[model samples]
Every structure is written in C-alpha cells, then in structure tokens.
Target: MTIKVFDTHVRTKTSRYLHFDVLIEGNDTEKAQAHARQYLLEKGLTDEDIAQSECRFCHVEPGNPVVAQAISQQGYYILELQGCQED
Candidate 1:
C-alpha cells in the first residue's frame, strides 16, 4: 500500500511548536491534520493547543510493512522529526 506524509507543526500550551510528520492511508490533508490533532490530544494537549496546528502535504510513497501495520491498527503513524518528544 501507499501512504501520504504530512509535515505538521503544532503549538503547545507551553508556547512551543513541535515538528512532526504524519503518515496516513490517504492523500487527504484534513484527515491527516485530524489524526495529528488526535495524537496531540492523546499526549495531554488540549484543543486550544491543537488549534494552532498547521499541516501540509509533504510527499507520498510506497508503504512498508511496519508503517502499513501501524496505519492499519491506529489509522496513522507519527514520525517525529524534531523539537518535541511526543512519539
């Protein structure tokens, strides 16, 4: 299967922006953003904090077994690039 990668930035309540990549099953940016927001919520961030998030389509590529499995189970896979520890 192929996957879409979204380059995402999210501002925390602590006033720091986090950089991460979201890998999902489709090319829809809104769905990717939603998944990113859900991840932040699961990591103890509030909706206000997630309100400042920005997500853009970075690229698309063929999926391997690991990420494919992750997306199948959780609907998305987070690939942290820099500036945060919410992985």
Candidate 2:
C-alpha cells in the first residue's frame, strides 16, 4: 500500500520551526495532524494545540518497509530532516 507524506513544520514559543516529513497510512489531514501532535508529546516537544503546526501534503509513494512498523503502531511515521534532534 501507499502512504501520504505531509511536509510538516513545528515551532515552539522560543524555538525555530523544525522540519519533519510525517508519513501516514491515509490522507486525512486532521488525523495526520493528531498523530503528529502525539509524536511531539512522545518526544517531549509540546502539548499545546498544534492546529497551526501541521501539514501540507507533498506526495504519495509506494510502501516503505522501514516506516511500515511505526505506521502500524501509531498510524504514522516521522522523518526528521532538520533541527529536530537538538534541545
């Protein structure tokens, strides 16, 4: 199966916008955003509403075995591209 890839940008009150490619099993923007929020929480990033902190669908591609595991568990996977690992 294919996945919907959303180009995501998240910024904190005191930090710059961090980039992440959020991959989900479906194309629902709300669902994708929700999942992205959950990811931030898991990473201890933020708990405030992320309504303005999400998604622009960039592409659809074939299945990726690497991300399949995460998608199966949380309905999505995050590809960290820049400034996502620092404190």
Candidate 3:
C-alpha cells in the first residue's frame, strides 16, 4: 500500500512548538489529525496540550513513507520515529 508522511506541529503549555510527522493511511486530513493526537498522547505529552493542539499536514516527501523527524525550537536533539502506517 502506498503511504505519505503527514507533517504537523503541536504546541505545549510553554508555547513551545514541536514539529513532527505521521504516516497516515492516505492524504485524508481527518485521519492525519487523529493520528497526530494519538501520537502525541503516546509520546507522554499532556492531555491539555493534546486537547488544545491542532494538526495540519504541511507537506510530504517521497520515500518508503515514514514520519520524517521532530524538530524543537530550542534546538534539542529529538529522536526520530519510523512511523508505522495506519491500517
């Protein structure tokens, strides 16, 4: 099955933004948003931030279809996830 990387961002209470990506089922925005919420929760992000957070696919890249990486504004070394494709 073909897949695409859904790029998005989530903001914390400190007003810090986390740029990340999700491997969605397709180019559906709803699915991407849902995946973003679930992904943040799984990463231990607070519910408040998760609730207040909004996700939007910035763009996609060509490849085996995986979440690219997470970049922090503070320049923190963020771990990259080989995101799994949604069923």
How much does candidate 3 score in TM-score?
0.55
Query: Which candidate has the highest lDDT of all?
Result: 1
Model 2 misses residue 75 by how many Å? 1.4
Error of 3 at 16 (Å): 3.3
Candidate 1: residue pairs that collide: none
- Give the per-residue lDDT digits (tens) of candidate 1, residues 1-87: 899999998876677778989999888888998888887777778787554778999999999999999999989999987766743
Clashing pairs in 3: none
- For residues 18-62, write the lDDT of model 2, one tens digit per residue: 789889888898887887777778777765534347578889998
Please state the error at residue 68 of candidate 1 in Å.
0.6
| lDDT (0 to 1) per candidate | 0.85, 0.79, 0.52
Which lDDT tens digits does candidate 3 get at residues 1-87? 344566666667756566766554357778767666666676767677542455565554443322222222221112233322222
Q: Measure candidate 2: CA RMSD.
A: 2.3
- Please provide TM-scores, in order, for all candidate models, with all chains considered together: 0.85, 0.82, 0.55
